[model samples]
Target: MVRTQDLTYSYDARHILQFPDMHCAAGEHWLLLGQSGSGKTTLLHLLGGLLSPHGGFVEVASTRLNNLSASELDHFRGQHIGIIFQQPHFVQSLTVEENLLLAHQLAGFRPERRRAHELLAHLHIGHKSNVRPNRLSQGEQQRLAIARAIINRPKLVLADEPTSALDDHNCEEVLALLEREAGQVGATLLIVTHDGRLKDRFHHRIFLQSTQA
Candidate 1:
């Protein structure tokens, strides 16, 4: 579901980052391991179509991201890619359920109220459906973020530093939830993290070296 070749990105002429080729099949769960400056998150962004690569190409679910126009990329990402950032960002004014409903709408699908509730319930936050996001605890908020990302049943799921801030128990819980939910939707799961706690959890792994040249 995800592939990249000779992918490169640069913030300036002095700092160029090059990534190794990668391939992760549909429904597979993989871990992207790297140190702080290894460009793991950058590669994830390129794959998700949030950033255009300086060289080479990113393909997800058979679509070559480099060939898409900005609007087309946005639409494609909304419909096929789901991302969970290190920090969750939400529409603070909107209720939890509304935030998820908006995800479906943005993906060009009718908002399915039942699905939203079901997802929230699975995440153990169904009671917060009518509450504003800002009112939830950090753990609850993260669960909500997970629900929002998969609400559209994306073909690929990208998570960046998802367990860095959690305790051991919570870390395990979050990882299990991620794997379970992604499997339920048959989505390829790629987690970009520097956390050592995850090294043994995934059978498929990609290790990146720092390329800050």
Candidate 2:
């Protein structure tokens, strides 16, 4: 679950971003819609504990992110939050399976190769398990990213512009995968995107408006 109150951030005295109070219950799916400069990515980072808010709080899975130290936040995020960025980032030097195992190791859990392979199989990229990430096609890479995100069965899944680069068919496919996979683990799913095409896909949504609008 997630809850935010009076969340505000600014780079300087002249500019500020204010976010609406929002809440998502356990296992709920939400779309965070906004235009560019509406603080969608900023808010996502705050929610993921990647950025410290200049004001207010971001709570996830009942933990107040503002209260955590940098190291603690990193650990907590690894264990509880799964983030899918607009561009998938991976350890190119490592094979797909190795990269997933790294996630488990970073989260302080014992590596489970069987679980990792099962996720890759579920994502339809089982054959790419031993291949380096760079060799995969775009769609395969995307699916691999999904596999990595949910591999830990995180409590909260946050995706940033997940469908931005896909065609309609791929867009729908990715969204369905995200929803179904997250739901399987009873995780709360929140996607932050400016894509209008996603507006009708999710029943719960929050709009981040540009302060200058």
Give the alpha carbon lDDT tens digit for every residue of 1-213 in model 1: 899998999988989999999999999999999999788889889989999999999999999999999999999999999999988889988999999999999999999999999999999999999999999887888788888889999999999998897889888989999999999999999999999999999999999999666
Cα lDDT listed for each candidate: 0.93, 0.91
Candidate 1 residue pairs in clash (backbone atoms < 3 Å): none
**Model 1: which ten-residue window has the lowest total lDDT?**
137-146
Q: For each of the candidates, give the backbone clash count.
A: 0, 0
TM-score of each: 0.98, 0.97
Model 1 earns a TM-score of 0.98
RMSD per candidate (Å) reads: 0.8, 1.1
Minimum summed lDDT over a 10-residue window in model 2 is located at 204-213
Backbone clashes (count) for model 1? 0
Writing each residue's lDDT as its tens digit, candidate 2 over 116-175 gives 988899989899899999998877788888878888889999999998988888888899
Q: In model 2, which residue pairs have backbone atoms overlapping below 3 Å?
A: none
State residue 159's C-alpha deviation in candidate 2, in Å.
0.3
